[model samples]
Target: MNRLSAAFIAILSLSSVAIAQSQPVNELSRAVVQVTAPDGSGSGVLFERDGELMILTNRHVAEGYTKFVIGVLEDLHQPVVPTFTAILHSFSPELDAALLRVTMYMDGREVNLRELRCRRNASDFCIPEIRFASDVRTVSRGNEIAILGYPDIGDDELIYSAGHIASILYEEFGGESVPMWFRTNATISSGNSGGLAFNPATGEMLGMPTSISSDAETSTSLGRILSVEAVWRALEPDRVMTTWEEFLPPNDGLDPAMDPHYGGTELAAGFEPDLFEVEVLAGGSNRIHTLPMECTGYVASAPDFRLDWSGETTQLHLFFEAFDNSDDATMIVQGPGETWYCNDDGSGTRNGLDPAITLDNPAVGTYFIWVGSFGEGDFIDGTLRFSEVSRNDF
Candidate 1:
């Protein structure tokens, strides 16, 4: 082989291994692809093997685009962006999860993409062909989760942000920590939608950052992650990429209770005085904070409802559960200038909350703050649980 080509090969080998075994925080640009359109950018994880290729991002990330041709992780050798045939596998609008299949070049043998190492680590986790993590336990309120994506940051390269698991909203009707969503302190800039948020230990995916705080401020305080359940719901049973496939339901078939996708829920508009009492500590536990989870009516139908906020409450991810027994419909809304509003049908946070979203972000104190059913026809009938609510600044 020519000296130049040989040197290039050596570089690729070393860099891949380096990234695989270590904590390459915010280094998602390494093997992931970005979907750039006229006005936006999205992130996708690179899954290569068996001569087959694909990218995992939010369906909304593609924004109706049908091409995967971006090179990231700057050190890799594919200088010229190689275009791949992109196919939309499945999508769930409400959950905001999507999958794309990319036609790839393969030699004589099959290849599995996970074999490509990016972050160097002491342990090599043999990522299951279908790797996923569920029933996630928040180790700390400020349990940090790093994402791989275009950080809306105008730097023209992939950027990373660290976020704590902020608050978990587990509504009564919506059910179970909304395994579909998570809030974070990570700054998910303009172009970061659809990138991967994963656990460093297992290399198992946690979710993708879908939204970031859009309000104008010195710094944005909140970001959002779409859980794997979103991906499963949008994917065909045959292609569902999680531990869930073995007991895969019939196409589009779902059970309301045991299933992650569907269930009735009662949302907490906000905190009511009689609803809660606080407990401070000299030190904390595995969780940063804990909230109450049982009401009078539906104790038996409840999930864990245990609020585990680790780190300092400010750096913790507090789990919240709300019950709605008002017999009305409600919505969670975010408006401008701290004008949080709730009456009989809605809830919102205008100034942001405290404990802050993570250790880095700070509490955004705005004027508007309400969390109960608003107006008319927005309340409902059921018991709700709230993990905990604390103030934070990111």
Candidate 2:
């Protein structure tokens, strides 16, 4: 090769390395926050937009409490802890996802993202808001990725793990099937749930690290990522609270019975029975009920129907059938003495995407049934049937 061509190639390679070094991985690291509960801890993303700040984490991670601490890394891996109380903004337990809004202050002041800092040259520096990939669909298997979180590595330091996308999996929810998850060879531990998974090439978030699977024999760990699209579906505009008053001190408590806006649905006592009713007999045909798009709340949050089954039946079977294979739905049966039985994504014949419940020797009394949409503003035009079955059949 000529001397001039060789010199040009070296200069281009040098510039490429400089550009790669200037990328925003350091700033993205700041967006990963440590979420702590009374029982355990996990990682959450610090989402900030238009002057509003919120944290997104797994539903299981934020379960059982309305208040927790948001930990930001400072002083060379030590955490700056701030206590904040939050209300359940929205959640889908079947999806294992939850969105909580900070409501009140307990022991410390509210989190000021500007003051939050990360370490560089034995000093701290302010970081910018995290960026999310516009479309996860563009991501293909074998693409390089990075997973960042506060893993329980005997310290509070933020851990960054790198791996490649192994495969994409399509799962059904509420009757609709979509490519909702991707598997990676990243190392994720117990505290890595809800952590951010980013495309190293662009520093854009691809998904959240929600689960990990290990082959017992090979000891190979596979990380399961909930796609960013799923996160967007969970953060539907209708489900999000627009005003701050909705999450204030008096409303910050976790009990749905006490908070009217807890899950965007009123409780059982306030709910009136639906106008339509269907009676099912043993060895009888299935009764279909159309769940309109207006059915806004979720399985644990909405009141859908009232059922009276005071017959000489040993067991009762309920099924929620969706119109499409990808649509998702939830069912909750509140029975005698305020007992509750909830099911999401039916088992066996139902492909684990529909809700089904079998009550053996259920109390012979009136049962209030509630159905909820799995997706945001998702109108489920489906059929619901209840049948009396023999105990052995159940």
Please state the error at residue 131 of candidate 2 in Å. 2.1
lDDT, each prediction: 0.44, 0.63
The local distance difference test score of model 1 is: 0.44
TM per candidate comes to: 0.44, 0.53
Give the per-residue lDDT of model 2 (tens digit) for 271-334: 2332122321111111111122212124333234556555444556777666666877766566
Task: Enumerate clash totals for all models, in the order shown.
Answer: 93, 14
Question: For model 1, how does the per-residue alpha-carbon lDDT over 52-109 read when each residue is reduced to its tens digit?
Answer: 5666777556533444444455333222143334555445444566666654432224
Which ranges of candidate 2 are over 4 A from the true structure? 1-23, 76-87, 103-107, 110-127, 173-176, 237-394
Worst 10 residues of 2 by lDDT: 281-290
The TM-score measured for candidate 2 stands at: 0.53
